[model samples]
Target chain A: MRVLIPIDGSECSKAAVDYIKERPWNKDDSFLLVHVVEPIPVDIGIAYIPAAYTPDEGAAFTQSEALLQVVLGDLKSVLTNQIDTKVIAGPAKAEIVDLAQEWKADLIVMGSHGRKGFNRLLLGSVTEDVMKSAPCSVTIVKSAHCSKSE
Target chain B: MLLNLLSAPKTNLRSLTNMKILISLDSSSSSQRAIDFALSRPWAEDDEFLIVSVVDVDRGDMSMASAMTSPNKTFNSEAERIVSEAKELLHNYLPQHKLETRCLSGPIKQAIIECAKNWSADLILLGSQGRQGLNRLVLGSIAEEVLRDAPCSVQIVRRKFSRREDQS
Candidate 1:
């Protein structure tokens, strides 16, 4: 199966990786790990005083690339089947759905309710958006924290 | 408001020897893919399979009262056809399993959940999405809702694809 997983560097999203790795899926199944980097927030400069050095667009790209690299490193330990990584810049929900549709992925497995469950007044913002809009079947694996709290 | 076409006996004889697997079925291609995936798994001697189809009255009705009325004759026949077709399709998967079929009415998600709970299903299997063309504004996700609240674990499957489209 072609599995598409979108990660955000959150432990919850990473737990999605852990869940897939632990499952002894057939070796023929391949995975596409996609990470979307939202553009630098417009208010970053105004929201906080320049107590620390500010990052330019190049700095931000480099940072996001490094984060993807770290995620790739972690996944390397678990995924023996064919796997690929992609880092793009766009809104999380739309980009993830577009990638899955364009890729014609058969399955989308991801962590559920990672960031917004506690603070955003609603649960599963990005994951829910993808689940509702994606072109393929989706599996929302509960994060370690989300499961524990439940 | 949910309706059951088949209210299983309180004591299901098959549950003792098999895992009661509730599989939601429809005429859609995605639903076929879900059945294909489930049957591919190596089966134990007794693994119960209940194929289900839910008619979403709420989606088409303007009011809950209109939707909650008794199942119309047209719907009753349609549900019967769907149940029989699903049973026939599952017959090829494992002939020894003695598969069951059911039809549910009401909002799609809640009806499926209620059926699963009533059957004491060990697992709920369904297509990730159903009959798309009604934009997100019209309908949210049935699979996502079931995943969050079902009494048991859920598996969402689709037509298997490869990493690259050309390879498939």
Candidate 2:
């Protein structure tokens, strides 16, 4: 099985990593960890060009790499299968879905803040977007702290 | 074989030790896909499964004539059959696993959430038909609601896309 996990350095994303670690995945199963760095808005009154990587974009790329490394280290302790990481700069939802499609991921597991009411409507959820567009199964893991009970 | 755990005493003993999984089903093929996804996954030996189908009695038009004719009976039996069929399929794959089935009646999303809360399920698995655009907004999505309100983690199974489908 091919599992794709998207990380964003949030508590909810960490919970998603924890969820994956706890599962008893097959030995032959492989995993791909992805982090998408949304472009930083600039106030320049000129058309932006993709020819050169801005310093801000470079820093975001570096930060995302570090994030993936930390998650990969944690997964390495429990999983011995082939685990790979990718860092891309794009909208998180669209990038994640496209990566799943390109990689032929059998499952895409991600974290959701699980916001409710007006908050959810206001914030809009990347997890929800990915769930709608991903090419394979999608599992939304909520942080244990946020989960509601009777 | 579908076993009803409503009155089963072993639930108390096994509740804490096993992972309780609540799988919501309907008459749609998407629900069958959810069951198939569950069967293909690896589970702990003692993990218990509860298959539930909620009969939305209020859905569709309820006219006096049809109401007098006992549409509730038909809806309930259909719900029962859906759950039992799902249970039987899962039982065939995991014959030794503890499995139970129930037919619930209420608003579909609320019933599923309430059942998961009451049963203390560790996970809730269901299917999403991947309805897009205007259809999704107008019809709304039960899977989305359950995922939002569920007391446990939720996995939404989707149709497997082949390379051929992707190309087209």
Candidate 3:
């Protein structure tokens, strides 16, 4: 089986990785870790003249690559299966579902919430969107904090 | 650093035995596929399963009134049949493991979650109706709502891509 996991360097995402590490998976199953870097939105204002400032694409990719490497090392310690990593820049909701469909993933494992700052307000639009359009099975792993509260 | 972060405090070793799994099933084909997917996975020898189907008394006005009035005759038999069918399917494959069937009457989502919490299930496996477009917008998904509030990890099973492609 092919499993796709989307991470965002959040505490909940780490819980998802831990869940995958503890689960009993087949020896031949493969896992792919995908991290999507949402592009910084450009300000569109009609009244004020803004300075010419472009978002640094290079820095964003570098950070995403480092995160993936760290996650890969952690997963490798527990799993002996074929593990792969990919860093993409796009809307997380669309990229995750598209990647799962393109890769023909059997299952998608992810955290209930992502690394957005205002977590209390925007609970998890990315997860909600992925769950809506995923072409395969989806597993939503809640963090220890969330589960304990219930 | 990453390894340390990933190491959440686990109370007990999550071994492949004695896992309590709660499977929520309804009369939909999506739920039937969920059972098939559950049986396909590798489970521990001593794992226990609770196959449940909620009567959804609040869904229909007539059923709600009947549930309050007659109680026994209020779509309870349908829920019993749903759970029994799932139990029979699993029993053929896993005869040694403990299998229990239950019929619940209440709101569908709340009943499933309440049962899972009381049972202290390790995992909740259910099927998504796979609703899309305007229908999806109008009617909310129970699987998604369960995933949000479930005490344990929730797995929303779906048909394979190959099978879906063949059908389309």
Best by lDDT: 3
Cα error of candidate 3 at position A7, Å: 0.9
Q: Each predicted complex: what DockQ?
A: 0.10, 0.22, 0.33
**Ten-residue segment with the worst summed lDDT in candidate 1 chain A?**
A48-57
Tens digit per residue, CA lDDT, model 3, B99-147: 9988887777888899988998877888886221126563337887887
Candidate 1 reaches a DockQ of 0.10
User: Could you give candidate 1's per-residue lDDT for residues A49-141 as a string of tens digits?
Assistant: 232223334544456556656666666687677778877767789999999988878778887665433443243678767777778777676
Query: Which ranges in model 1 have alpha carbons more than 4 Å from their true place?
Result: A40-79, A116-123, A143-150, B1-21, B28-30, B36-50, B55-84, B87-91, B94-102, B116-124, B128-167
Position A17, candidate 2: lDDT: 76
Isolated chain B TM-score per model: 0.71, 0.76, 0.79
Which of the predicted structures, 2 or 3, would earn the higher DockQ when compared with the native?
A: 3
Query: Model 1 misses residue B113 by how many Å?
Result: 2.2
The runs of at least 3 residues in candidate 3 whose Cα sits more than 4 Å from the true structure, single-residue gaps closed, are A41-57, A121-123, A146-150, B1-4, B7-18, B59-74, B130-134, B138-140, B160-168
Residues A1-150, candidate 3: write the lDDT tens digits.
789999887766877887788777777778999888776555533332122112234666666777888889889999998899998877889999999999988899987776645444254778877877898888887655533422
